[model samples]
Target: MENGIIYNSNLHFEHQRWKGELAFWKDELKFFNNRLSELVTRWTNKDVLAQLEHYQNEFVLHNEVIEEMLEDIEEHETRIAGQSKTGADALDTQMVKKHLEFRNRLETQRHIYSELKKEFFRFLEKYM
Candidate 1:
């Protein structure tokens, strides 16, 4: 799966990048939940609404990133299919191979994010 670009190094980088992103979002989600809980405890904290709105916006941005990644993967797959029918040359073959590897990595990351998202919401729902 390394495509030979320093094989294990690239694979390790991909794994680290994926896990780092997952860790970031997981932390942000937890921070929002905790802040919301703290705000709920105070009687006169009326500005916490803005913080929640910020969290919502951040969530949307992250969601968009995921959606765009999915769309890109789909686009690559379609391109690969079309290129094959057209007797793709060397460059096209290389592009398709790269796309397939990327899609595989992104899909794996997506699955990890999904499970983390579910856990985040489940915990927040308990407080809500």
Candidate 2:
């Protein structure tokens, strides 16, 4: 939701969900930044490389899934905006279906993030 946007007829549940996800990602980035920095500072060369590999694999999977979902979200929002102005076509219907599918994947990714966060904390507790 935009800063000044009100809960009017134009409001969408999808929009609210996306807004919450965006905020979550922002917080996740900051947490990752600080934790990664602290990890790098304390680990030895070989341990650092191994740790980097671990995080790299985890981050790559998360990033790819998140990016794909975000792309679908953007495409869906564009379709909705365009159709509202000029009416929906067959492609618009397809976009709506794709959007629903992507939203499910987005929710799955959120669960994945929570699991990865737990793994991260466990790693810190055992190793650091």
Candidate 3:
């Protein structure tokens, strides 16, 4: 049997939620970047400096990814709004597929961010 359809309203809510999560992550990355700056100024150990630089680069990359994701989410939300104006009760199969893809990407990013966060804390505890 074919999978059932999803409501546009539901997708809209989900997109909003995803945007909120991304915003929170962006703020967290900013905070981490700030902390890394402080750590960099205080430490001169070669190994620690290397690790700190790595984190600094990672945070910048993560922030860029978050910005891209936010843009994608905004576009998706716009498409959903357009679809809703047509009085459609269910999203198209293609839209549903895109939704799943977006969700998967978000999950993967979250996992990577979580691991990086843990590793960063461990580094802090070990060096600081």
Candidate 4:
């Protein structure tokens, strides 16, 4: 953001970067799900199976959150594009605020997801 104004080019780049990160997370989640499936199949202990089920539910919920965030990002990008006065115009204060809010939400999601990933890996090490 330059002088509280976000240029169109900058916004586009930021949006693309965030979208790419989200896509990678989605793919990683799928891989994690596959691993969980394998563990669930091999494990027979009731306690271990229950923990696997818990992780499955968490991953599913995180997937939904990722999808929702992607949709919201698309809508925000569309809105920004629609409001652009010129190809290289800058966003207004309100748009800047909105973009910052999105950035914060994205960071929060990333942090939470990272923690979840670490927890899952620890479980795998202990049980798998």
For 1-128, candidate 1 gives per-residue lDDT tens digits of: 34533232333344456556655765766676565666466535445555445555656666666656645545654554565567742234466467458758677767765775675466456545
Tens-digit lDDT track for model 3 on 22-111?
Answer: 999988988888888888889999988999999999998999999999999888888888988889868889988998999999999999
TM-score of each: 0.42, 0.70, 0.92, 0.92
| TM-score head-to-head 1 vs 2, winner | 2
- Which regions of candidate 1 deviate over 4 angstroms? 1-47, 87-93, 104-127
lDDT for 49 (candidate 4): 94
Kindly give the stretch of ten consecutive residues in candidate 1 with the minimal lDDT sum: 4-13
- How would you encode candidate 2's per-residue C-alpha lDDT over 33-125 as one tens digit per residue? 567768777777897659756875786677666666667666666666676666433333455456557667767877878888888778778
Give the per-residue Cα lDDT of candidate 1 at 27.
Answer: 73
lDDT of 4 by residue, 1-128 (tens): 67666687798899899999999999999999999989977999999999999999999999999999899888878877787755648877787788889899999999999999999999989987
Between prediction 1 and prediction 4, the one with superior lDDT is 4
Better of 2 and 4 by TM-score: 4
- At residue 28, candidate 1 shows an lDDT of 68
Model 3: worst 10 consecutive residues (lDDT sum): 1-10
lDDT values, one for every candidate: 0.56, 0.65, 0.88, 0.88
Q: What clash count does candidate 1 reach?
A: 0
Candidate 4 clash pair list:
none
